[model samples]
Target: MKIEIPYGDSSETVELADRNVEGVLYPNPVRSGDEQQVLRKAIENPINSPKLEEFLNGKKRILLIVNDATRPTPTARIMEIIYPLLKGKDFKILIATGAHRAPTEEEYDFIFGRLYQEIRDRIVVHDAKKSECISIGKTRHGTEMRLNKLVIESDAIIPIGSVEPHYFAGYTGGRKSFLPGVASYDTITANHRLAISQDAQALRLKGNPVAEEMEDAEALFLKLNIFSIMTVLDSNHKTYAAAAGNLRDSFQALIKKADEVFCVPIKRQAEIVVTVATEPTDIDLYQSQKALDNGKYALKDGGIIILVSACRSGIGSQTFLDLLGSEKSCKAVIEKLNREYKLGYHKAGKMAEIGLRSQMWAVTPLDPETIRKAHMRPFRSVSEALAEAFKEKGPDAKVIFIMDGGLTIPRLT
Candidate 1:
């Protein structure tokens, strides 16, 4: 059988024997609604809170928060829908950079789309390092809720985000735009440290300490007038569902919709798994590691998990590479991560944990040395990586191809 897996902008073809194929994991078949109608209805008829137009009634300065380029959130599309309401208001668009760097020129274009030229001056890129942050309070879990002051200064707040299965914190979007999205370095570092817990995993939120802390942090914003627009996109990035209204209500309301788009089931684990991270998530090793995290669940112990990404931007976080290289084993790497926990170390920890149980390999454009430093072997292409896996595991080895590992979570039935 021959299959083409996405890698960056292109796809890589890998051929395997009929007996060697386990199954190709793709997002479940879901009905995609009209994008405009989905956004319009969500903005008009909200969940628990009043409609968006009503929420913006008495507000003075409006602050629009959006995810960085890392997420597939259709912020520009949302902006287009709401710009008419914000026409006369004093609004500034803030990029929720979290601990990541500001978007590059091209990324800015990708983020703002056609409105870039018009709203260029109104845009404020979040700087976790230099941005002024105020303490909102502390989480019930004891993590401090210091965040960007812009959230407090602005009279009206609107956050546009997409919800999907997150390896940690259960899912991304909702309160996430507040925590790691617009949070201070210390706050983000403290919250993300909880990701080391076994309870922090995909499709779960009840006991996830990271998520709990995030919810706790957002609780402080209850006094403020907030209308959060959360969208659930199908596999094609078409808006299939959306919710608008109060913060927590809108976020929680979209969970079932998100599940419809990301959850995939398999009858059994496979000996080899190929997971590809595409486009923006494929920009670097740090972001692309998400594929490995999700694919790990479908891989047998000692099996090969090949991450296919371009990683053209190089190792995203030097701290990650340093941490992974500091220890000879993933166990040691985890020990160091727990001791000197940082914002990006959780990424390192997740990758290290997976490498502990499986053979980590990659077919990325990243330098071979860079790949090896992260405890993963580098292959020239998906075919090469698959050939290597077959050679080591044997001709009859079962393999699984995760079509969109960045967002797709493979579950065992």
Candidate 2:
């Protein structure tokens, strides 16, 4: 069997005996509909809230919060739908970068598409570390809501984002465009600290402290009269579903859609799992680690999981790498994490936790030494990594390929 694993903008092919393959997992093939029409309808006929025109009435200043370059959100397509509606309006576009850096010229183009040139002057790249913020009380969990001043200045807030299965936050979008999206660095670290808890897991929001607190932070923005637009894209990145209106209501409407596309079910765990981080998620090791987290769901304990990512920009979070390199083993890394938790430490903790139970390896553009420092054996190619993994797991070891490891969360039946 020949499989094409996504690597950044391109893909790499790997061939294996058909019988040795368990099955290749891809995002569920969603039934299609006209996405542009759906989005326009969603905006005009919203859920549990007024329509876009109604929501815009009487509001002087509007703030549009959008995802940064890391996420595969259809921001440009969304802009196409609403740009005419927002034209000549008193509004400013803010890139919700969270703790990530400002978008490069290429990334800015990617985010706004053709609209970049038209609205470039009105765009504000949020600088979490340097931006002034105002505290909006604290969550019951004690996470402070230090939001960007841009959020408070606007009388109306519109958060445009995509919903997908997030590794730690159950799902991404809605209130997320507030907390970690445009929030202060310290505030983000406070909220992310809860990620160390096991309850903060994928596809679970009931007891997830991170998800709960993220929702709690939403109350702080209610005074701003938020009208949110959240989308769910299919395996091909085409918008499969769209919801608009009340922040929570719109998000709730899209969660099912997100699950339909991203939550996959498998027959059994494989002895060797090859997971590939798709596109923007493969931009860096830190972002690509989500693929590793999702990979474990399809892998057996003590199995070797090979991660395939381009990591073209290199290690994303230096703190995450430092934490992993500072410790001799994943166990020690977790111990260190427990002692002093930082913003990026959660990534290391999760990866380390996985390391305790399984073998981690990677096929990426990064040097072998950097991969070694993260406690993962490095390979120049997925086939080479799989060959070595199979050597240890045995020639008959069954392998599974997770086509979009960053987004597809697999569950065993």
In terms of lDDT, the poorest run of 10 residues in model 1 is 7-16
Of the candidates shown, which would achieve the greatest lDDT relative to the real structure? Answer: 2
Alpha-carbon runs more than 4 Å astray in model 1: none
- Estimate every model's Cα lDDT from 0 to 1: 0.87, 0.90
Segments of candidate 2 deviating more than 4 angstroms: none
RMSD of each: 1.1, 1.0
How close is every model to the real structure, measured as TM-score?
Answer: 0.98, 0.98
Residue by residue across 1-413, what tens digits does model 2's lDDT show?
Answer: 88887777777898999989998999999885887887888888889997888788878898899999898888998889888888988999999999998889999999999999999988998888999888878888887788899898888889999999999999998999988999999999999999999898999999999998887887766766799999999998888999999999899999988998998989999999999988888989999999999999999999999999998789999999999999999999999999998889999999998999999999999989999999999999888898898889898999989988999998887
lDDT of the structure predicted as candidate 2: 0.90
